[model samples]
Target: MSEVLLLLLLLLALGPGASALPKPSGQRQTGPQRNKLLLVSFDGFRWDYDQDVETPELDMISVRGVKAKYITPPMLTMTSPSHFTTITGRWVEDHEVVHNMMFDQKTNLKVPHKETLRRTEWWDTGATPLWITAQNQGLKVGSFHFPGGGAHYSGQPIQRHVFETPGFPDDNETEWRENLDTVLDWFSVEDFDLVTLYFGEPDNVGHQRGPDTPERKDIVRQIDRALGHLRRGIDARNLTHNLNVIVTSDHGMTTVKKRPLVDEIILNKYLPLLKLASFEILDYGGFGILTPRPGREAEVLESLAKVPNITAYSKSQMPYSFHLGRSQRLPPVVIQADLGFNLNSRLIVYVNKGDHGYHSGEMDMKTIFRAFGPDFRQNVVSQPFDSVHIYPLMCRLLQLQPAPHNGSEEVTRALLVQETDGASRLVSSLLLLVSFLFFFV
Candidate 1:
């Protein structure tokens, strides 16, 4: 068979669900403003949030554009790693951002997530992100409070970026609108080809008021209002036809189960914390990492395995799907709690009613994914896929050659529209022509 036929067969067989790479397509950067993309992330939006609260904006977008059942995040799902996975199209293993906090194994030091954003060493760990890849291809890009936006990757920073203040009000509608307007201006005035805007939402309220609370429902309404404002801003700038918008989140939140209802994994109760581990990152939401002392690896794993409502895995023994075992930054052993339970250190009380950071398989751990634009199919609901696939979709929408990433274009290509389908048709036509020539000649 001709190479074209063989390639076409491969794409047909693999493009819908397999880890297929996207072909750089007919798209080119020509005019002053080429194909533009806007990525918006509302932190900790569960897949079922709209089902609980009336989200007219999200509903309207689904009717007019594309929606996914949900998107699965990388295991040990947290803000930094999941967001990095979405933008870099790499698992935590490839991107090496395994946690929300940056932990140093040698010094046993851990930096908070916001402070880690400015730590170049943490973000510049050899993986190139979408912004840097686009800029390298001569596309102007910007970021608004997205994770890793403040750091340099491959010695290149996003052309324009903003960071939220350490203590910004999470639910202020006015502040959210201001940020949305600024992003719109970046596209209309500054001509950014791609921009990532993040909102620390419903995530904050989810944690404070619990995922099952009325407070979370209220915050969801606030988030929907912000989405409406985003739509209005895009329309006001005459960018409706030029821009593609993807709104998603890092991870979903679940209600935390306390004692008497379910036994939380309090590590110090099972193992002598001071005796076996050199460094312990615990009392967090749903995950913990332990660096065993020079000779106590086996003991630490064994003791942790005995903790109720949790699973313990040595680095190599982690489930292959977790995609976290290969990072040198990760600890020797990792512990993850059941969906609603959290891993805790002895005497460190975690009072938050809702939390995340569990493995991503649980229904409650799956998050939202919605996209709308001139490039997406209207009223189509796609199947759930991993968050990693998003990076390649953005690359295709912007017509930029993607950096090294683990995402497959096949899974997300179904959500796209005429241009993407036209590319597929062109490939099929080429295959037929090549086959005819090979057989007749």
Candidate 2:
């Protein structure tokens, strides 16, 4: 199919559940501007888990700055897409990273002559991330291994560095500190305005060891310690005196109780009205995407409405808060198998541990967000915040213009220091002086 027609097909598949942009609120109000900012992405962290344990680094940040109690991400709640939203202020449709694995259109013989990996440009389609933006604005940008950071950032002049290796290790803390040292080393020679670091142990360990497992608990503590080390590193450089720090995550995790197995024939028996576009036979059950053939969408929708152990949604029916759009990468009819039903397979497998990609009821779906710096206040606002909002807020804090994909509402004023009449008076005096000087000249 032609590229235009293919994109249209994808948009139709996204259905009506795609999210729309929200109205602008004056949440990006300026504060006493800061000289630098640091963002640390703690992948796959939950808002509430192992509650008995204390997050001292985060708690310290709260005491010094502000903490939003919760930060929710868009549906599918995966890493790449959420990270895209968090940094670019766009949704899955705009970013074009609908899922972890890009579609292999060449696999279908119908497109036998089609080019491979051509349409699978997940990293290329989105708006420039914060690092790219900062670099373009003549500010130094440094990044550790984020999901999409390794991809070409439209040839932007941002510094990309890998401080940590993938997969979990016993000495994750050591790796984290080493990465901190690398960031510090770079900062020592360069005056970077924005820095991004990512710690992957928590997410990896949680997925393998389960959130309730002792191994996962230890990993969380280690992550907290790493954050402490990070703070010390910043303190060592004296950067904190005028810098802003943000801690956040991409998505949360969920637990699986029993893997539900479904026969392809049995599933097809009930899904006659729907045309299955993609199918994966997973350990717990199956993961699949469906669409209506030709004009049969209404029948498929009605059939999905009657299905149990499944949550089916049209593209338009998706939560508006996510801000997704009708794009070709999406399926018009989406199906989320019942919680705990793992689609088991050798190549595509879940570790039978606590993981994500289930329902909203999963605690692992709740992520984290905490910011501290000269521009923020010491308020503990417990209102739930969206992960997508962090990108826009970061730009606002750095006093940089936002990218075209920024669909998020700016953070509320409660997160920042209160404006004062004294500053206003100073501004008035400066304006009056400039006006007088202009007239005299």
Task: Tell me the spans in candidate 1 whose CA falls farther than 4 Å from its real position.
Answer: 1-28, 260-262, 419-441
Please write out the lDDT profile of model 2 over residues 120-193, one tens digit for every residue. Answer: 25567756887777766666778776666656666543576553343456345666788878876666567667
Residue-wise C-alpha lDDT for candidate 1, range 292-350, written one tens digit per residue:
99999998888877888888889988888888888888988888888888777877478
Off by over 4 Å in 2: 1-33, 106-120, 163-171, 259-307, 314-322, 343-349, 359-363, 406-410, 418-441
Best-matching candidate per TM-score: 1
Worst window of 10 by summed lDDT in candidate 1:
17-26
Q: Each candidate: what lDDT?
A: 0.85, 0.62
Cα deviation at 427, candidate 2, in Å, is 16
Worst 10 contiguous positions by lDDT, candidate 2: 108-117
